[model samples]
Target: MKIKIISSHKILYQENIISIIAPGYHGYFQILKNHTPFISILKNGCLKLESKNVKKKIKIEGGLLQVKKNLIVIIL
Candidate 1:
C-alpha cells in the first residue's frame, strides 16, 4: 500500500508500506493492503509503518487520516 505523510510546510514522507498503525481519536488502529476505505481524526501519538523487515515510527500532534483504494494519506 502507498502511504504519504504531509505537514503544513511540505510532504514529510511518501512510500509504499505493508501496514500502518496509527493513533485515532478514540484509540489506535491498523491498516493493511486492500483494506476497506476509512477516514478518521487522529490524536497526539505515534504512527507506525511496516514493510518487509523494516519498521518506522513517527510522532504526530494531531491530524486527519484518509484511507482509500491502496493509498493512505496522513495530514499532520
Candidate 2:
C-alpha cells in the first residue's frame, strides 16, 4: 500500500508501506495492504510505518485518515 502524510505546510511523508499503525479516536489500529476501505479521526500519538527495509515513527498532534484502493492519506 502507499501512504501520504500531509500537513498544513507541506507533505510530511510519502512511501510504499507494508503496514501502518495509527492512533484513532478510540485507540490504536493497524492497516495492512489490501485492507478494506476506512476513514477515521486521528488523535495525538505516534504513527508507525513499515516497509520492505525501513520502519519509521512519527509524532502527530491530530489528523484525519482515509484509506482507499491501496492508498492511505493522512492529513495533519
Candidate 3:
C-alpha cells in the first residue's frame, strides 16, 4: 500500500507502507493492504506506519485522510 502525507508547506512523508494507524476524530483506526476505501477526519495525535519491518510515526495537529485502491493521502 502507498501512503502520502502533505502539509500546506510541503510533503511530509510518502512511501509504500504495510500498515497504518491514524488518530480519527472519533477514535483510532487502522488500515492495511486491500482494505476498503475510506475517508476520515483526524484529530491531534500521532500517525503510525509500518513497512519492511520498520515502524515510523509523525505528529499531526489535525488532518484529513482518504484511502482508495491501496493508496492513502493525508492532508494537514
- How well is each residue in 1-76 modelled by candidate 3, as lDDT tens digits? 9999999999988999999999999999999999899999999999999999789988989999999999999999
Top model number, TM-score: 2
- Give all candidates' CA lDDT scores: 0.95, 0.96, 0.95
Model 3's TM-score against the true structure: 0.95
Show model 1 residue runs off by greater than 4 Å: none
User: What tens-digit string does per-residue lDDT give for candidate 2 at 11-59?
Assistant: 9899999999999999999999898999999999999999999999999
How far residue 73's Cα lies from its native spot in candidate 2, in Å, is 0.1
TM-scores for all predictions: 0.96, 0.97, 0.95
For lDDT, the strongest prediction is 2
Error of 3 at 71 (Å): 0.4
Ranking by TM-score: 2, 1, 3
Candidate 2 lDDT at 27 equals 100
How much is the lDDT of residue 11 in candidate 3?
90
Which structure is stronger by TM-score: 2 or 3?
2
Alpha-carbon deviation at 45 in model 3, angstroms: 0.5
Task: Please give, for residues 1-76, the per-residue lDDT of candidate 1 as tens digits.
Answer: 9998999899999998999999999999999889899999999999999988889999999999999999999999
